[model samples]
Target: MKHWTEDLDDDGDEPLVRPYTITGGRTTAGRDDLTLITLITAQSSSGTDTSAERHALQPEHRTVLRMCGRRPVAVAEIAAELDLPVSVTKILISDLIDAGRVSARPPLAFAQNGALPDMTLLEAVRDGLRQL
Candidate 1:
């Protein structure tokens, strides 16, 4: 069988584009609010100029919009789903948020406190597993 990389047209050794190129050489997401666990969702009503703005966006930006358009999703999850680095994903997401195409909020408050799972629930789960 042919190697997966060999299957591509000649010059398969070269990547189509570098990761940094996607962010226009910017290393930061440009927003302090975005974090790995931040939750993001598409806006229900993207005001008037949204269409033009969307048309001008890179394909990566469009992909991020589609993923969050279905429902709220965590920033890390988005990165995983798209196979992009978290920092790069954050930059794309921040751009979308700034354009009013999406909304972003911090992770759930409970996770912030580093609380442990309830022992009672853990015990119940263990007991249920034992019964099985």
Candidate 2:
């Protein structure tokens, strides 16, 4: 039986590019507003054929725009989808935002003004659970 490694083709051995290279070696996104839960979406006015424009952008940037084009997505989710660090995702998002190709907004704030959940609803749920 042949080993799995033997079945794979090897080309002498070239060093793989680093992840940071995708962000142009920038460690910081340079924006203070970006957070893990921040939402991003493609700007409708950015023009059609985003794929055509993507050819001019880096692969990472193109991937992000493509995902956002469908609907709003969270920063953390984008990072997970692309298998990139959160910081790197933020940097790429920042670039798209700066280019006016995408829009970013913080997660929706529920119950503004320090409101609390109704205790009656909680009690009802507790009673239902107990009955089960």
- In model 1, pairs of residues that clash are none
Q: Rate the local accuracy (lDDT) of all candidates.
A: 0.83, 0.84
| Candidate 1 runs further than 4 Å off | 1-15, 46-51, 110-132
The superposed Cα distance between candidate 1 and the true structure at residue 69, in angstroms, equals 1.1
Find the 10 residues in a row with the least total lDDT in model 1: 45-54
Name the regions of candidate 2 deviating beyond 4 angstroms. 1-16, 45-53, 110-132
Candidate 2, pairs of clashing residues: none
